[model samples]
Target: MSKVRIYTIAKELGIDNAEMLSILDDLGVSYKSVSSTIEEDTVELIKGIIAEGGSRAAQSGAGASTEAEAAQTSQTQTPQPQTQVQPEQVAQAPATAAPAADSGMTAEELAELAALEAEEAAEQAATAARAELPHRAPVVTIMGHVDHGKTSLLDYIRSSKVAAKEAGGITQHVGAFEAQTSRGKVVFIDTPGHEAFTTIRARGANVADIAIIVIAADDSLMPQTREAIAHAQAAGVPMLVAINKVDLPQADPERVKADLTTINLVPEDYGGDVITVPVSARTGEGVEDLLEYISLTAELEDLRADPKGKFGGVIIESRVDKQAGVLATVMVQEGTLKVGDFLVVGENYGKVKAMTDSAGKRIKDAGPSTPVQILGFSEAPSSGELVASASNEHEARELVAQRQEQRRDEEEARKKPRLSLDDILGPLSEAHTVNLILRADTQGSLEAIQGILAKKETDDVKLNVMLAGIGAPTEGDVLLASTADATILCFSVVPSGAVKKAAENKEIDLKSYRIIYEMIDEVDRLIKGNLEPVYEEQYLGRAEVRMVIRHPKTGNIAGSYVTDGLFKRGAKARVTRGKEVVFEGTVAGLKRFKDDVREVRQGLECGINLDWDEVQEGDVIEASEMVEVEQ
Candidate 1:
């Protein structure tokens, strides 16, 4: 049966539209307006509520005449008077909005017209919401190669020694702080490097206004330097290159500028638009010119924000503090944030009980372009989570509930198995990951094998054929397979004596097939986790923790001495206490001599940070790296 519009139900019940809406709200039935349609079940439920003495301000159109008096009475009625409707009962509704039964139109058609009118009205309302306030400072993000003086540059700009606080004098995490420059106030985001910078740029969150690439004049362009420039290009933000460490004897600003030209970042001295400044973070040489250029860029960009706008910010960093609860450092992009205000962030809502500025000073409120730490979240919100303000606690709770429900629905959808190659290969799991290199005698054979591999790869277990070539197996193929730790799969191809010798020496698996079905069956078995591994772990170093030191900034770390070989950062680690393996994870961090180091040799003591933190004294931490070997 067709749904009945609200006006028709109101007319049949001998009540005004406003009174009908009041009953709907009191009954907790969601609705839009008089143009909205109600299901037959809902209509019966409403009637039952009214019959049971449901309370409303008015009934039978009483106490609502004055509100409807201003509406134009231009609608023609049909013989059925029950479908008659009055204007102004649905919040200044149009006069031509006759009930569905008399309007000779479907309920959907009426809703469409009402929605069109509402959209126009909403547009007008949005135009009126543009807030006017003081101008905002420009937020700058520093990005470049590691150890290229990104943190050092910020240190010089803020007149603070931030790098000295880090483990290896390298920024390990993303952070933002405001600075007072000669050209007005500016905010700087000291990120871990271009990786974090790219992550922040990839997010739609409004964060950075300018990107400053710190290039060491001595080191010139590094791999990460080009990567940082590429990220800045993709982000579409204006950039300035800070040729750092110019005070050194080997500093060559001209060479740096020449190298930058190859990447389209031509310097101003080269008659290009890109600006470059030679500066030393240590000596503070040419630093004033850099700040002046930043101010000039901000002025040219005309950065401004409305402090009274709807509160919105992006969480740049968040961590669980041992004392102050969850501390979330947020970059305020728009509007104002103050203590006692409720904020909703990704299924989590928190009342801001306190705020601290960049300088670690307490602040009452923060405006746009301000970085403030928010305390009071029961749990730490994720980085890059967007913040939304609510008028009160009730609204914030409602929003959180809605977001949580949505997240659960999304998770349920994700839990379903994806339709991919798994249908052919039974079911693929993470343990079934296989890497192969396809070598075939003919192009057609190569494509056929590739087709089989590409038919349907699963996310859990993927069939990665690094290279597909139509040729006999060669020494190069063996070398590549040895390097990538992959198996060589051959279809109608033979290997020479040299290639075989090389494969035997390197222990690279070589599977040759004369028939396609035989190959497919073997591949199915291989991808199903039946293949033997061609790589083995080579022990790098072993360390015994003699002491455990606790610190407020770095957390719990093991003070250990390398006994056998050496310990390396990012190497696969296994922590063993006596005979039981307590933790099997990567070495997250390693430090020696109060500085971060990549590797430490034997008979030397260093600090080890593992993913598993319950490390105790006398625990043996073994570091290992993967190496290709016989299957």
Candidate 2:
């Protein structure tokens, strides 16, 4: 049977689409949006819910919408006339099956389309087997402030000296390990505690089922400690506090508990749900209790994944080894990962040549919540990327090829001209913009830098970070910088002497910094003083708001009439109420009626959605474009 959309079913029952969507969410049904197709079984399940007196709303209790309750009652007692199924009610099939145009597509486009089909197929298969999967282990992550004994605690649990092996006695990398507790097996992820590793720690929380926050008893709560708590809470993961260094002479668990209460993490002993355990990683005190608490929490969560279907997981860490080639530490989330299985990780494909557990023992297979070092990736996979086991080597290779093609297409799309040759030779203008290329040694550093640079903008001066990537600055970077009249900024990455010489020959500025503070300082200076203005923003159009439509997946899409000039998709827009600027962001999407267009002429109606922080119905949207000019 062809899948029917949730909105169609809602229309048939004479209920609001949003109400039905909430019902599906309460029933634990997976859906991307109301337009998403539902299986035949799911359709029957909804009918059964209506047939059973529709008590699901009451069971949800407090804050239940009375209108929704009436709608459910009407669904059961009265049968509305059948509505005609709309063309959009049918889920569109994979685009790969659509014949290419007469001109045919490039190999890259074909590969990307094929990869999308494969991924959609995999998702459907995983959903089919989801209901039958048994409960799996819960993955827990440890996060805290620097020198708060996070690694030391993991070492005590695993009986290994990982802390001693770390550089500068601080955890710099995210590590995953499994421990056989008396209650059961619990997987643990150790995340770095430094402020610079914020992205890594957030990724850790995102993938874990539970979080253990370590706070030194002697020091109480620190700034990073608060940040770690915020990350775990933002991920919606349950957290348990581990007060470490309690064996110290100055250790005070009560003082730490008071600080935790201030952050809204009241201890269970203090009449709250947050569980706080006192322990000393140095002496192993209260460590067993901590393990027991973790097992109990996992039992309550009832975490599970299919062990009989296609294997899938996420890459926690990856590095290139001289002898082992590309080794990746992967934590399996669903199904069973066995030796010799063909796998696609990010843009890399490989056959599993060997699997070693955290203890260095060769394992034949791994199930959910198991972290193992696997050898065989063709290249180093990125951390936090999803990994799926394909049916065979051919399928894995095709998937990887498709992903690589998609990446290339995205890079090409983002390759706007930083500065054309003619523009560079022209005189200065009013709009001062500094174009830059950023290269970093790691993903974490790149993310940190991007976040920092995004906030370095002024009314007249704009810091446009054209490209950011991992690895050292290369000749290609120098060429791009020379063409765009942009500078090459490197963080913790040194360019080869030959590349530096090439940059010097081209008279392109190349700067490198080991410290984030120093890099930010230099970028600020360049944006404020060194960069010359070449263009100024000119008003392209103004639109009067007509209506606002809230899309489930795309947020708010505005319906407006172009009052003057022309409205375009790529133009920058600012929302104003009266004379005050409410928001300033890009026009991320635009449409005319049902069809999408590049631009709408004056006195035309169109739909627009901004990348702005917020949008209201009556806000006036003023669009502008930067126009080049000579002084």
Candidate 3:
């Protein structure tokens, strides 16, 4: 290593930032800040100084050395660019005999130099791309606690009952709108306020020019409200506090302001730069002032994008619309998106047959900062992935293929996958081997995955691609994988009910993924002994209470309407009544029109029995299940 940041070194040694600074000061090492990088030799000296500090420091140093050794080992395992050097370069080396001082450095040193050059080139390319991109309208993200009037505020701006149309009158997914206010044209991203959609909120903040954190005046600061602020700060986006529900009798804006100071978000009135506006989403009071503030802030920031740069955007959400096939909502960040443009999104490629704005109005084209729903993809693209234009259909396909191949090759095998209980506890085979039966939606996807696995093959650890095909996994595949103790991986394809049941019975590991990166990542993490916990709550569905049935025998039967996702009979459930989780239990029973049911999709009505009597009208019921997953 040439140089490393002090914070990075501290992290490697599992020590606090302040402790690292203290140690550096004690050693008489000169550093501008924790972020300042020091030379490799200086770092070694610092390590030696720590080792001499006593036994406690010595033990820490020992642990840190082991960690450093492991990191170095992994780096050595990585294939070097020099290994793929062209024959012309090797032949030309002898021509420069005068410059070959002691035959120059070894292959390892040369490889490191090549890696550094490659990194610098990549950074320069990124800088050039950013400089060339044109600027567009300001993109603002709305974030806050559940039922804190985020949707209501947008509804007011758009002059529509958006909240009323949403499931449970709560936003379930991210939605973007281009608002042409009196002040200026600004794009707003409405992110789900529910805790389950924290990732989406973070994504929203990441893409936004400003974050308007909605805080309910009556509620002050809730858990999700605090989380929203943290996300905005982490994303480095300018924030404007919107204290909503100001019309409520119990509303107290002062309490919200007080809580803001605790989080280091002091308002302008409190001798801080943070701007706070009290608004009533229900009545639209003070909303005009909020818009003016956002517009002014956006103008001051001078956010820009080049409309002539390569067309690109981020997928806010993608789904299979039963009538329209694959539909993806993309917010154009640069260049221009047209109706007939062919685009590549991550590993999926598509042609834009049509483009519709947030209001479902069809349009010919969209510029930077404009959100549009595109139709005519081969399949639904992965959410939060990049979507950019290709020269043509053939070019789009080729581009996505190359991307998938590069992605798989770039991923580190032992650090990619989520940790299942089986992965963490299962004993490794005497022979280091990973057997797999792979299935994909397309031949290209299958080939891409196989190419990466081939590269992962080593003398010590054998990677066996036992079966690679295009389609959902069959019962036969499951049986063979079971007998061989191999894993079954499905990319963009799902196993049938029979196949799932067979795998369950045989205790075979079966995994499915919609994105190529996630599939490869999970496989990389499959190498046991290098695992991280991946137990996550997978959201199933959300529902709203239509009517509460006080059944004589069945406790409280919630006559609910499914809002978002689906509801399973035995799924883990939570009931929220106006920002508070009133009940957390299981979906003990489910029914449709008085008939017992196993599953219910969104936009449907069903009777749900939580085995709890506290079910009330207007309460939101969310269904989820804990499973091993990754980001």
Encode model 2's per-residue lDDT on 307-381: one tens digit a residue.
776787888778888876888888888788999999886676888999987666678999888888888888887
lDDT of 2 at 97: 48
- Residue 96 miss distance in model 1 (angstroms): 26
Backbone clashes for every candidate come to 2, 0, 9
Q: With candidate 2 superimposed using the best TM-score fit, by how many Å does residue 311's alpha carbon deviate from the native?
A: 1.4
RMSD of 1: 27.6
Runs in model 1 deviating more than 4 A are 1-133, 160-174, 409-631
* Model 1 alpha-carbon miss at residue 22, Å: 58
Report, for every candidate in turn, its global Cα lDDT versus the true structure: 0.77, 0.76, 0.76
Tens digits of per-residue lDDT, candidate 3, 1-631, equal 6889776787677665677878878878876545456889988887776667666777888999999999889889995443454434544454332433343555444455666877999999988877565547898878888889988898788663222333344332336877777756888776544231334332332457888889999998875675566445545678889999999999999999998896677876676767889999888899987887787667556578888778878887778877878878888888889988989877878788988877666789988898888887878765567777988989988998899888777675535767875665444433467877788998789879888877765554576666666788876566456445678999999899998998897789999999888987877776543333346889898999989998899898999999899999999999999999999999999999989999999999999999999889999999999896652
